[model samples]
Target chain A: GDSVTQTEGLVTLTEGLPVMLNCTYQTIYSNPFLFWYVQHLNESPRLLLKSFTDNKRTEHQGFHATLHKSSSSFHLQKSSAQLSDSALYYCAENAYKVIFGKGTHLHVLP
Target chain B: NAGVIQTPRHKVTGKGQEATLWCEPISGHSAVFWYRQTIVQGLEFLTYFRNQAPIDDSGMPKERFSAQMPNQSHSTLKIQSTQPQDSAVYLCASSLDGDSNERLFFGHGTKLSVL
Candidate 1:
């Protein structure tokens, strides 16, 4: 079985501050594909980025994540937070099934 | 593309009643997925179909729940004897491919509330 873990239930940060959302996963396969999906208020979850190649930095919409198979972690990072960045972030492992994390609620304030 | 379309944006059912949710996947997508979203459980996979066939339904409850994909165009999730705890947003998504790296297009979802 595969699973995903998101440590931050909620993360609060001021605009322009650095932000990081922790995401880790476990799988039996070495080349497991992981994804980051963002869901805004009253909207469906949409893919933000995905990566399977370990150690490669995948970036999209000012956010970046490096899949570290050595640690089984793919931490989402952004140099500066924006007001629109406030949303529920989900980390998912695409194995036999799509195992999604509990999600992290990020609130960016001015 | 209309993306994925879920009928009855909201559904209200009495406890012990039945509820059926409908989902129309993208025109050509072969993979369709159903998930239940709630604050307590987050996103929970219910079942999925590929090429109009039941692929993986291990996530579905043994009793009182069933899913059918009679054709490639539409799928239905039926819950019988619904309970209060069954209240959650039912989401349907479609992907060109089911692999982890493929992009999944999701519907607005049907918010189900059991009275």
Candidate 2:
């Protein structure tokens, strides 16, 4: 069985501040592909970033994440948050079928 | 490309009625997946097909839910005697393959409301 965990249910940040959304996963497979998906209001989920090489950082749309296999973590981070950054973020593990986390709602306030 | 296309942007059905949802995967995509989304369950995997063949359906409800992929272009998910608890957004996604490395492209989804 494979599972993804996002510890924070909600994360609120002021505009221009840093952003960090924690993600972790558990799987029996040695090489697992990790992905970050973002969903805006009234929109479908889209891929933000993905990584298969452990310890290498992959980025997209100003968001970045590193897949640390030793720690089993692939946390999303951004240097500065904008109001548009507010959305639902899901961390997923593509082991057998894609297993998604509960999701973290990011609310960036101006 | 149109990405994935799910018919009936919204579906309202009476309890105990049957509901059939349609999904058209991206052209040439080898894998098609069905998922249920809710506030409680972020994204619950229902089933998936590869090369128009049934693969894994571990998350689907055995009695009331069934999915079929008769061809490469289309797939259908049918719910018999739908319950109120089945109200959620049904999403269809397609990828180059059901493999671990590929990314999924999702449809707008069909919002099912069981009244």
iRMSD in angstroms, per model: 1.1, 0.7
- Where does model 1 exceed 4 Å of error? none
Q: Please give, for residues A18-104, the per-residue lDDT of candidate 2 as tens digits.
A: 999999999999999999999999999999999999889898889999999999999999999999999999999998889898889
Each prediction's DockQ against the real complex: 0.79, 0.86
Question: How close is chain A of candidate 1 to the true chain A, as a TM-score?
Answer: 0.97
Show the lowest summed lDDT stretch of 10 residues, model 2 chain B. B37-46
Per-residue error (Å), model 2, residue A87: 0.8
Q: Write the residue-wise lDDT of candidate 1 on A1-110 in tens digits.
A: 78899865789999999989999999997778889999999999999999989899999999999999999999999999999999999988886768788888999999
Off by over 4 Å in 2: none
Candidate 1: give the clashing pairs: none
